[model samples]
Target: MSWTDGPFMGFDTETTGVNTATDRIVTAACVEWRNGQTRERTWLADPGIPIPKQAQDVHGISTEYAKENGRPLDEVVIEVAKVLETCAHAQVPVVIYNACFDLPLLNNHLVRLGQPTLGERVDFLPVIDPLVLDRALDRYRKGKRTLGALADFYQVRGEDNLHDALVDVRQTIAVLRAICTAYPQLGEMDLRQLQEYQRGQHRQWAEHFNQFLLSKGRSADVNEEWLV
Candidate 1:
């Protein structure tokens, strides 16, 4: 059986804003499908800051709600990092939708809290990012590449809501399985090769996107790394 037939983990986060460096994590989730068994952990964090309405609209977690019921950010991040470390140490591939956003955001928070960053924690964790995979495999496919769109294209079941970390993480795995089913070539590659492929693919996309940004006179630097 392929690695896909064994175990994998899904991780996602909902934060105060898009600025991964400064924004706070409001909620997070880690889901594991191991030996065909599903285990999930979810956390809500007070974050100690006001959550922008725009961000709150996306995930439905309000600052007031979080303050009332959520755990402190430092404590929350500690536990979340442990879960991530344990899974990745086991070499279980982590399925993250837009790894660039979530992973950096998680890492930044960890660093600020004086905890070990992902790079300091693991050698190299195999990550399956469906968004990166889709763009790599089919660069010319025209429509939206959001998780919901990919789920619809692959006929994967999506959650009723899009931004909830748990729902999004679960759907990400479903879409990955669908991608592997449709593209056997992907599954044939081992984890190292797959991550290398994603790195090359990310480089390709970054170059392309950089040019597009330059054309429009926009200049936000895109990180070239695929995984942390």
Candidate 2:
């Protein structure tokens, strides 16, 4: 069966802000799809800091709501980490949209909470990042490459609640499936080969983006790392 056939995990997080170093995960979701069925786990964490109005506007999770109904940040992080670690050990492909952002942010949270980072716990591999793949495959296609944009581009039906963790994960998986349908060769690749291909594609995209920034007299700050 193709990698897209079954047994993949879709992960997504709604956070306080864009800075992975300081932002906290307010909500996260993992949806494991196998044999045409899906099991989902979701978390709402009291991030222990004010959820800025700007961020709240995006995911609609306010600090007050989180504090009232959420688990402790440490508890949420531990549970999420366990799910990720289990996926790694099982070699299940984890489908993430912008993996570089989410993976590093989760690692930062683990370090902040005095827990072992994901890298120390397991070899997180076989990641399927539709963002990197879409850019690589459709280099010149313009407009936007946000999850919502790609969903629309790929004709993947998405819910109105685009920014919610669960909704985003579901849409991401749909978009990935649509991408595989368009690029049949991607369905033929082994998990490891697909992982390496995305890694290389991300690096090349980063380098090119950095050069564009430099040409515009801006700092070339994009990290070339795929999962950092």
Please count the clashing residue pairs in each candidate, in the order shown: 0, 0
**What overall lDDT, based on C-alpha atoms, would model 2 receive against the true structure?**
0.91
Candidate 1 local lDDT, 1-228, one digit each (tens): 677675888999999999988999999998898775789999999999999899989999898999999999999988988887887788888889989888888889899988899779988877888999999988999999999999999998754788888998889888988888888888788898988999999989998888889899999488766764
Instruction: Tell me the TM-score of each prediction against the true structure.
Output: 0.95, 0.97
TM-score of 2: 0.97
Which window of ten consecutive residues has the lowest lDDT sum in model 2? 118-127
Best candidate, TM-score: 2
Candidate 2, residues 10-111: lDDT per residue as tens digits? Answer: 999999999999999999999998886888889999999999999999999899999999999989999998998988899998999999989889999999
Whole-model alpha-carbon lDDT for candidate 1: 0.87
Q: After superposition, how far is residue 33 of candidate 2 from its true place, in Å?
A: 1.4
Local accuracy by lDDT, each model: 0.87, 0.91
Model 2 regions more than 4 Å off? none
**What are the runs in model 1 whose C-alpha is more than 4 Å off?**
none
Root-mean-square deviation of every model:
1.4, 1.1
